[model samples]
Target: LRSTTVRNLDGVFELMAQATKGTRDAAAEEGAHVLAEMSPKLGSAVERQIGRLEADVEHLLDEVFDAQIFEGVAALKSHDNYTFEHSVDVAFYGVMLGRKLALGNEYLKDLALGCLLHDIGKMYVDERVLNKPGKLTASEFRQVMRHTVLGFQLVRQMPINSPRPAHVALQHHEQQGGGGYPNHLTGTNLLARTPRERFDTSRMMLLSELTAVADVCSALSSDRPHRAALPATEVLTVLRQMAGGHLNRQAVEAFVSMVEVFPVGVHVRFNGGKYAGSYGVVVKCTPGAANRPVVRLLFDAQGAPVPEGVEIDLRKLPDDGELTAVPEEGVSVEEYAHRLAIARH
Candidate 1:
């Protein structure tokens, strides 16, 4: 007989808080059951592959290589599953960039190890706090942000030598604007440098940037705490825009190249044309015409389509007609899913 007035995210929190203790317990239990009930077999093969890399490389293997990581990332269609897998991927990539930036061998391993467990801090955080759909309240955000220092402190308890991992954990959120928390010192504070300069990015900066890119890319490219997966091309667009005085430009470029902006079998919209999967191994990636790289559009996620497969070899076209555009509309993995369902029928 009563209508509830709901306004901001607070209402949701209030509702959650008001939930009967048993009710909340049951829900959490069920959530855990569902998570356990579902076999994470989809990512099993990918995880196995990563595990096969050198012991030190188990973390950085995918981060350094975009294609392999995305392949694993794309396997996750839900936020929970994606977050579980993507963090590892980001850590791996961060270590890769740290190594490329010529961080010493010890730092390289420590950085890799640090990244491997940077978000391990989150384990101390509540899932509800971590996965809140809307913006977090200041207190809640502080609670969440505390994971950085908390993670560092926690890892230190594990008897790890070489403090780089804990520092990486601590600095991952420390930004260039000197705006990051848990130690908000700006210039000369935690790799703070001129915004957007490639060289401006220090070793920790590179690790953080690489981690951020990998984190967001994996987040957007797959799914997240609040939303479905974003298209890889659109994700890249967002990353480019996000680089405005925040992340390193050339570093991002290096990352894009590492990941093959247009991986094989990804449907893309070329300039003046329709949709098709990745044309071929990325031949070149320029800020201009980044999407359409003279791809040989394949029918499936694999090389070429079979049976009634259609492959458009853009290599045949002259330079003037080279592929040069990205998709205008938001491409949904859902649409692809629907198509697959139809094909199955």
Candidate 2:
């Protein structure tokens, strides 16, 4: 199975090299194509194939500078495309956060490449273990964890211009204070000759730390083999809880401040108040206040269409008025029609 998977991936890589054009979306799409072809395989074939993406990856970064982080949560839950889509989401998040931190252009490009291919090593793990519907046994879990080292080794062998990007694949799983996998690296460990230096954030490479933040956000917002995607609000709460211990405190805070927890395009329902039972789609979001956005009311409290849409700015609503995410199952046919009505607006 592994050999077959590797052979298929090699063919896919050759196709990607031929199909990838200079456009950023093309590069991104071709890269995703390669990712979708991955399975439990490892070796020079994987390494060489990844090298084929270098030009496209660099070209993709140039285009990413003006791109917004797309909110494609509904699209991402499709079981077959989850891995590829998740990688794209991570790249979007990492590059944007890199911009937020004022990283130089070169650094941003490296961050983008690293985040996009960070999980390539997962291709080396068996599909059974990777997609098991229940909790992994200890041995299966260890196989999953080994992807970090496998990814690091695979990336190191590639012809990528910079070595720093490889480290993002290697260390994004490492924690701040202590307990993490593969290597128990800390944020400030190298400079911690004295105890005081341990508290500083400079020891770990900034790109790695930033990618970690992006990686976590993307993972929480995505569906996995074992679980459904968490609502964006719950994802934010989990991110906050992990800060300072499991994640870099400063990076987490910066990410949270910039990302819209309740991003546009999601259908939401009023949790309580006069508007309770009303349905709407988020139309706009403010950076600093992610939980609240401008919603376009589509359905009334009685579950009937509003006829003519009405806009409400959630930030201006009373404290008791709250918007809750509507599950995929909760979207009605009428709501879907309204959602389609303004999709391009």
Candidate 3:
């Protein structure tokens, strides 16, 4: 409920994590009950839960786009909670991206609501296929893809007046050049435009385009049963690669500008340089230079933990590639918490 900008983001992140967990739990319960009873009267609970978190979402926007915090927060997800957690994260990312695109307050409200329930229809999917840890067969993938239409149908049944949220659920998966599913809807073409022009003209992409970018970013950056989360740097690269083809280019471009690639509290390793093989945690991100953060080295080249980490400003370094995201195996939520405790003490 705190709206102040936080200097120590760890505590703020913990609060936001609790909010997302609560929202996720409530949505999951409501979605399941609605699915089983078939009377479809649980929309109010989902809406109420999301409404309560609007302040928290605004707080999240004030802080860093810490992918590591989300990685740790989303670790709270079990197989059953995946969709709910994903929905909240998408809402967070979507609203953040929407603000970057200058989509005013009214549009942002709709975007947040749309992103929150964008995957509600997944409650109707087969649990086995939804949580399958292995590659899905073509037919299984097809079944999984039906969540879009199913989600649209489910959202339309809700009491909301605007159809924008329902359309978001339906068209989030749709791609440019007409290659997407459920409906082969083609989005606005930004390929011929400049970044400024794209930004000026991006509102036509609307709620669905914003949600699509957010959805892809959250899915790729978070752990899946099939694979571990990609590194933030790699996620940035993937977002760029998918921009014009699978996602809204204007949204993706705006997202890349705002995302914290080496977010605070993330474990990192020196890819090369004098500190090669040394491990560290990102302690700060210089605004507008997310890829270059201030690091506090926590482990030596021999993998021994340092009692007191030495801080290094990445921007002060001569080379940009001196530091890189640590491999997924190298990061531990405990280690991150421990480092924060040390800093706080």
Best of the candidates, lDDT: 2
Every model: Cα RMSD to truth: 14.4, 10.5, 10.5
lDDT of 2 by residue, 279-307 (tens): 88888887666677898887778666664
Candidate whose TM-score is highest: 2
Candidate 1 — which residues are off by over 4 angstroms? Answer: 1-80, 99-104, 185-206, 265-267, 271-292, 296-345
- lDDT comparison, 1 vs 2, better candidate: 2
Each model's lDDT: 0.48, 0.66, 0.65
Candidate 2 overall Cα lDDT vs. reference?
0.66
What is residue 161's positional error in candidate 3, in angstroms?
2.4
The per-residue C-alpha lDDT of model 3 at residue 162 equals 68
Q: What is the alpha-carbon lDDT for the whole of candidate 3?
A: 0.65
Per-model TM against the reference? 0.56, 0.65, 0.62
Estimate, for each residue in 158-211, the C-alpha lDDT of model 1 and write its tens digit. 435556566667767765455665675233223334556435434344455556
Which of the two, 1 or 3, has more TM-score?
3
lDDT tens readout by residue for model 3, 220-239: 77788888877667777888
